[model samples]
Target: MSTAEAVPKMHKACVYDQPGTCSIAIRDVPTPKPGPNEVLIKLTHSGICHSDYAIMMNTWRQLPVPTQTGQIGGHEGLGHIVKLGEGSEKLGVKIGDRVGVKWVASACLACPPCTESLEGYCFNQKVSGYYTPGTFQEYVIGPANYVTPVPESLSGEVGAPMLCAGLTTWYVSKPTVPVLGAGLGRMIYRLPELTVTAVCELLIQNMINIICVILEYSALLKCGASPGQWVVISGAGGGLGTTAVSLAARGMGYRVIGIDMPGKKQDVLDSGAEHFIDVTQFDDATIGKEVKRLTGLGAKAVIVCANSNKAYGQAVSMLRFGGSLVCVGMPEGEQVSIANAYPSSMIMAGHNIVVSAVGNRREAIDVMEMAARGVVKFPVRTVSMSELQSVFEEMSQAKVTGRVVIDFSAA
Candidate 1:
């Protein structure tokens, strides 16, 4: 093996050092060396995400293991290999190869979950930015076999979100489950069949597409919400909310009432909702009454996408008699008190909650296929790395619409 030149001792990284209580501070920390079958990467771009919020704020409940101080925090990194450790050459990778790291850094493939083709549920998974250091730094290490290989034609900015936020449009993710990521950099992307333009358009529009299956399959055909019935979506401006809006209207032929703060009205309407509910415009109690007034004694179904206990409570009130309340988005806590939080009479009156999370491989294939066929449309926004703090604030306020991507070169 040819020996590489001398490496740097330290590199610039964003450290989670309680810099004002769970705030971030950029520091020069010791650089990491690639060990056996590992590759050292020089990152070109990284995406900012909402899950980054859960990690930085520690809002999620205690885990069997929690992230430590001085750990770098970023998962959607686009970079190239700068150095390789022992045995890395045998993995079909080499120095200067472009790769991406996703939410899962490494998994113990010998575990039952991995063996069963459920690497996502691997008990011994080492998540980037969590268990191991992540790609928030300029240089990060990735396992040779796990890193995703990017097509040479793909740009770092476009490839960055493809590693994550791209596949995530349909799922209602729990903030802590590496819905963001656990590792530095590796990608499984090799779809040369898809052009960069086609992917961008598809990802954006496909974000505008699910939930018909859960509603129809679980609630009995037409028992939940069928064609010509009203289905309300809370948090309709955000990612999953918008997709629910689109699918409920166009895919299932339901009349969609999208409920969000005032700023999201246009995007919600564009997603194919028949109506928009400005939650901020009315008192919390009055909001339910307005929904009833518009949809005639409440909506036939309600999908909760806002990640809050109160949002779930509000969704319960928005449901009509014998209606279904679909719970999609999960808050920071492991379990939220809902269905039972209501009175027994309410439960007996026939209100039910249905939970749906990540989309499976089939779902992914279906969505992408539809997107490639030009069947969906959605808008995407790009943000500079320097604007990450504001991005979190926008998310916290629910002011942003559609999808957002992080451009690491801006860092």
Candidate 2:
């Protein structure tokens, strides 16, 4: 509501000066003027995604480069639209309207992927925090077509993660109707059932907590899941895993069996998982045996939200005949083709394996609204924007439990 004259001359931003180095500084860059069909947002809070840390650390080489020099590094941004650019009227965006900017900033409408609403893989797409200046800065320019509108009910902080992590899971965890008499059809149970053998390698040892990121919990409540359906959630204490457990169990009325370390049992139970498996202490073979014992026919579907080769292999081994394995996590190292060795026989027996990179955006508005209504809870730790560098360090070391959000208001 304030005039341009009332705004500060310069705002603080966290910039990646080089691959592996991030610094917070007050820069005198001019306020970015919005382009045609674009709107300017004054961001309040942004979630520090693990992928952002990966990009900053140059852990992955596939990221886009929009600037040869340093660039801003954040994608999950929730803020208010404070200014309109030329031709923005056609976009239907308004001043003070809360909105979110995500990784997929804009996609060329002419692309084949765009035509199919598969903008996540749009060939000529621009990415925030990668190819474009992202939300780490106080003000950001967002394209009309791709930006997410935050509803009036949710706070900016709670709405931030939905643009990325939440969307990824929303896309992967959606229920599928298996062919009748197939793996899921054989179960003949009312509630959705999931079975998986979870194995976690102890790369780092600490009392790490789990955090779940949700767009909206109430929308998930309306999904019509019933009791007795079994849902297996790996990384059940982490952001994505916890959210899946909460929605699948608490909101949808499904029975949740959490897969994580034994120490994470309390947190997993707190998130509504009916059972917990201490994955760190178990071996792959042990997990498979345990899964078979827990679910007689095996799990109907397995949602792979953790990014590890071991997890993928375990997921494949744990699935029952004709069951589905939904791939959500990406490999941190070289992209490897799905191993043929694990369940070579399962495919022949009618098993289904599916991969989804990001959740459907059309569902985001509804999902975020659920959080606003207090139907779903997002557990997060608020950190000052100035602590971003250290946060990355903690993330790299696996010392953090749950999601770490950067409070830009501290700037």
Per-prediction TM-score to the true structure, in the order listed: 0.65, 0.81
Best by TM-score: 2
TM-score of 2: 0.81
Candidate 2 residue-wise lDDT at 23? 44
Instruction: lDDT for model 1, please.
Output: 0.65
Top candidate by lDDT: 2
Worst 10 residues of 1 by lDDT: 179-188
The per-prediction tally of clashing pairs is: 14, 17
Model 2 C-alpha lDDT per residue in residues 261-371, reported as the tens digit of each score: 565577778878777888876787787667667877666566766666677778766666666676766657566666543555875756777666654456566557655
The list of candidate 1 runs beyond 4 A from truth reads: 1-11, 19-22, 37-41, 62-67, 79-99, 115-118, 144-166, 169-232, 239-257, 271-274, 282-303, 317-328, 332-336, 339-380, 394-398
